[model samples]
Target: MPKSVAGGTKWTYFASSNAQNSRSPEVLFDLLVSCSSEQGFSQVAYGALTDAEPTRRPEYLPAAVTVNFPSAWRERYAERRYNAIDPVVRRTTMQSAPFLWDQLAHKYQLQPGEMRVLNEAKEAGLKHGVTVPLFGPFGQLSVVSFASSFDDVDPEYRLSRLNALAWQSHHTFAEIAPSSEGKCHMKVALSEREKDCLRWVEEGKSSCEIGVILRVSENTVNFHLKNAMRKLETNSRTHCLAKAIRPGLI
Candidate 1:
C-alpha cells in the first residue's frame, strides 16, 4: 500500500478523545501505552524495534525501545533476547499495516523457539492481540501491540482504529525522537547506545552490570553516559538519567 494511503487515514476523533495539547513525547508515550485499552486490549506494548531485524546478538538487545510490558514478561524477553525470534519483530520489519498476532502466526510456520516465546506471552495474560506496525518518514519502524484475555475481537473495527493510531504514532514519534536517532524531529539527538545506557541506569544497573548485559565494556558504557550527559546538559548522572527518562528517551 502507498504509505500515504495509510498515512491519510482519519484519526481526528482519536486525537480529540483526550484534551491534551502537550505533544511531549513523555505524555504521548504514556498515552500510547494505554490507548490500546480503549480499543479493548488488556495490555499494550509499544516500541522502536530496530530498523534492521536484530540478529541474535547481545550488542543489539539494547537497541529496542519497549514500554509498558509486564515486568516478568520483560525479564524473560531480555533473558532470552527474544527479538531474534519474536514474530511481531519480523512482521514490523516488512509491514505497515495493523495485523493480528494470530495472522502472523499462521503466515509463518513457527520454530519451537518462536512458539516458546508466544506461549510464554499467552501464559503472561496476552491471549489475543493485534500489532500496529508504524513507519516513520525516514523509514524507521516501530510498533504498538494490543492484547487481551481470550475473547471475541471485532477485527475490522479494532484494526481500523489501530491503523489510524499507527499513523498518528509514527508522526508523533518522529517529531520527538531526535532526527539523528532515526527520525528527525523536535528533540535533541541521543544515540541509541546512550538511551540504552540510561535505561539500564533507570533499572538500577551499574555501569559494569550494564556493560555485562549489553556486551560492551564498562568504559564504553561510561563513555556513552558522559556523552548523554553532554547532550542532555546535566553534570550529574542522576539528573541526566532523570531527564532521559522523563520524556521517554529510553
Candidate 2:
C-alpha cells in the first residue's frame, strides 16, 4: 500500500515501488489518477512522440496518448485537430522545463488558434494546470499534464511533486508499451575514439582529465565526445552518456 503525506503532496516515493514492479497500463493509469487527485488535479494526460523529425512545431500528433478528460472534450479536441495549434505541445518540443498553463501567454505571443485552444480548454474544465516535459534516450518527447478545475492552484508547490509522478508514469508506460518505431532498439555506431571517450566519461572523467588519460588534447577529447553525442542524437554530455549506455554502445 502507498502511504500519503500529511498535505497530500509528494507521493512519488510511495508510488515508485509499485510503478517499478508493475507492467500493466491499468496500474499506471490508476497510479496517475490517485496521485493527481491527491494533489488536487482532477484530470491527467500523458502523450509520447516518436519517429518524427525533431522539430519545434506542433505539426505531429503524439504517437501515443492517454487521458482522463471528459469524453466530449476529448472528441472535440481530436475532431478539431487542436494538437497542431496547441501551444503546450509546441512548447514541449522547444524545451524540457515544466510550465503552468496560464504562463504560456507571458512566455510566447499566442496565435489566434492557440489562444482559442486555451480558451476552449478553460470552458471544458481545464482552467489551471502544469505540464512536465520528459525527453527519452532517443529524441522522443513525452509530456504529462495535470489539470485542475479551479484557478487558485499553487503551481510552484505542485510542479516538483507532480514532475516526479510524471516521470514514474512515463517509465512504467514505456516498459509496457515500448516504442513501435524501433527507435529504442536501434543501434548507433560510434568510432573507436568516440567510444573510448564516452567510456571514460562513464567513469566520471572531465574532458581535461580524459585528454591526459587518452594521451590527447582536451579539444580532441571534446571533439570525440561531441561526435558521440551527435551519433546518439543527444545534446549534452550527460544525455550522451545515458543514451550510449542504454544500448550498450560504449
Candidate 3:
C-alpha cells in the first residue's frame, strides 16, 4: 500500500518485491512514472552520463535517457544544449545529494544563462522538481528528476521518498544494462603498497603523514594512491577509499 505524506501526497516506497519486478528499463521507467504521478509530479526523467565532466558539453541526445516530458520541450532542450548550462546537471557532478530545483537559487549563485534555462523550463510547465544524483564506480553519473507544474507540493517528504525510488531505479538498471567490453566485471586488484596508502587514507591520514609511516616520499605515496584510483576507476581520494573499503580490498 502507498503511504500518504503531509498535504495528501501519496509516497510509494519501492519494496524488495517491486525491485524484483523492475528488471528491465521499460519496467523501471514505468515505475518512475507511476510513482511520480502518485506524488503529484507531472513528469519524470532518468539520465545516465558516461562522462560527467562539468565543463564539457554533454551530448545533445544522451545515449541513456528516458523521460515522460513533452516532446516539444525535449526538442527545445536538446536544440539549445541546455544540459551543459543546466545548474542541476552541474551540481550532480559536484555532489551525491538529492535536491529540489527551488533550492538551487538559494544554494548556488545562478548565472544569467543558468537562470534562463530554469525560466524556460518553467515556461514549458516544469515549475517545481526534485533531482537525485547517483555516482557510479567508473566515473559515470546517473540522475533522476521528478517535476511538477504546481508549487504547493511538500518538499521534504517528497524528496525523501523520491530519493529512495531513484536509488532503486539506478541499482536495477545497473544490473540489467549492457556492459561494454567487460567494464562491469573487471577485477580491481590493488597492489600491497596501494592498499597500504588507502588504509592510511581511510584513517584520515594526510599524504605527508602516510609517507612517513610507509617510509616513502609524499610524492611516492601520492603516486601509489593515484595508481589505486586508476585501477578502481575512481576520480577522487575519497571515492577511491570508498571503493576499496566496499569490497574489502584495503
lDDT of each: 0.61, 0.68, 0.68
Model 3 clash pairs? Answer: none
lDDT of 1 by residue, 1-250 (tens): 1121122212223333353355355565556655555666746665666554212224223654445557778788988888888877776677745688767668888788888878888898777778876543355556667777656766455665555554455444454544523222337678888888876665446799989989999999999999998886655554465345444565
Any runs in candidate 3 off by more than 4 Å, and if so which? 1-23, 52-60, 180-250
Q: What clash count goes with each model?
A: 1, 0, 0
Q: Give the per-residue lDDT of model 3 (tens digit) for 24-72.
A: 5666567667766777785888777656322212433574457777678
- Comparing 2 and 3 by lDDT, which wins? 2
- The clash tally of candidate 2 reads 0
After superposition, candidate 1 runs with Cα above 4 Å error:
1-23, 51-61, 64-66, 180-250
Clashing pairs in 2: none
**Residue pairs of candidate 1 with colliding backbone atoms:** 179-184
TM-score for predicted model 3 compared with the true structure? 0.60
